[model samples]
Target: MTNFDRITVDPTVMSGQPCIRGMRLTVRRVLEALATYSDRNELAQEYPELEDQDIKQALEYAAASLDDRVLELN
Candidate 1:
């Protein structure tokens, strides 16, 4: 498994959803925000605590989560 140090998951946090640096912010939220805000500056302004590394890791984590899998076609 790829190491995603920035991404943390805790049952007490966001119902165990993948989060950024154990923060209240979930990976899903970050992805949603990225989609909503095309500009990185705008995203930073909205989430000042979020660092570039965090964003990158979140994207990586998300992709890795979906990268390995087996699908059965009906």
Candidate 2:
């Protein structure tokens, strides 16, 4: 899914931070979990509602966002 489809910014959630599937979980939290964890199965176990694909999507979204750059015109 595209970042816009999977990630959402709502004033009621996490101060409008980009979140996954409109849930309270932020993209940063998902990325952090992936970074600190080795076993995908274990991670899934800890977050029963989230699957491996969710983590993958979060990474993809983060990567795509990193590619975005703001250019300054003089």
Candidate 3:
């Protein structure tokens, strides 16, 4: 699935931050959980509403965003 397919952005939700399937959870939140918890099963347990793919797709979206970037020196 594409990045936008699993992730959503709405002005009414989280101030338009990227969310999971229009839910209140943000990609940053999930990534933070992954960084701290460091266990997929534990994260799944913490946020029972999300599946493995949701977290996976969040990561995919972040990675894809970096893939399209260019850094410049002034």
Candidate 4:
């Protein structure tokens, strides 16, 4: 599957949070990890279920989601 295809959402999983390959790992969770860990390698060691492509695509997907939104400053 394409890296983007690795992202999926199901109400039964993670209470409908966006997840990777229908697994318990949510995209948001991974993105948050990026904040604490500077190296992707450390992330891999932390979450063995994650592949490089999974991390790349999750960022792509999250960025795309934000691009679709509009934020206004008051």
Candidate 5:
């Protein structure tokens, strides 16, 4: 697994959902935001606390999570 140093999971935060550096901002949310924002500058304007590395790790973490999982087709 890739080192997701920026991704964190704390039961006290967001019900243990994977987050960015233990912040309330979730990896899922980051992915969603990425889809909404046309550019990194726009994303940065929206989430000032989020750094470039945080975004990078969030993407990496999401990819790793999917790679480690299996889903049966209905």
Candidate 6:
């Protein structure tokens, strides 16, 4: 998925932090929840807006972003 499509930047939302599908849910929040929670079912239960695919997609998005990064020193 394109970063522009899956992730959005809107000043009104979370101070323009990158979010999933322009929703109020930020990627950082999602990742944190995933890291702390062991049960996907429990997570889905707590976050009605999220599904298994959403969680998976968020993880994939994070991974892709990390993989594409190149540190440059000038």
**lDDT scores in order:** 0.91, 0.80, 0.87, 0.87, 0.91, 0.79
Among all windows of 10 consecutive residues in model 1, the one with the lowest summed lDDT is 60-69
Question: Which regions of candidate 1 fall more than 4 Å away from where they truly are?
Answer: 67-74
Best by lDDT: 1
- Expressed as tens digits, the lDDT of each residue in 1-74 for candidate 3 is 47368899999999999999999999999889889887778877899998878988998988877756578989
Give candidate 2's root-mean-square deviation (CA, Å).
3.7
Clashes of each: 0, 0, 0, 0, 0, 0
User: lDDT value for candidate 6?
Assistant: 0.79
> Of the pair 1 and 3, which is ahead by lDDT?
1
Off by over 4 Å in 2: 1-3, 67-74
Comparing 2 and 3 by TM-score, which wins? 3
Candidate 3 stretches greater than 4 Å from native: 1-3, 67-74
| Pairs in steric clash, model 5 | none
The per-residue C-alpha lDDT of model 1 at residue 23 equals 92
In candidate 5, position 37 carries an lDDT of: 99
Per-residue lDDT over 1-74 for candidate 2, one digit per residue giving the tens place of the 0 to 100 score? 36456778899999999888888889999888878778888778877777656677788888887857899999
TM per candidate comes to 0.85, 0.76, 0.81, 0.81, 0.85, 0.71
lDDT tens readout by residue for model 6, 1-74: 54445667799999998788789998889999888778878787878887666677778778877856689999
Q: Write the per-residue lDDT of candidate 5 for residues 1-74, one digit (tens) a residue.
A: 68888889999999999999989999999999999998989999999999999989998888777746588999
Candidate 4 displacement at residue 35 in angstroms: 1.3
Model 1's TM-score against the true structure: 0.85
Q: What is the Cα-based lDDT of residue 9 in candidate 3?
A: 94
Model 5 TM-score on a 0 to 1 scale? 0.85
Worst 10-residue lDDT window, candidate 5 = 61-70
lDDT, model 5, position 9: 95
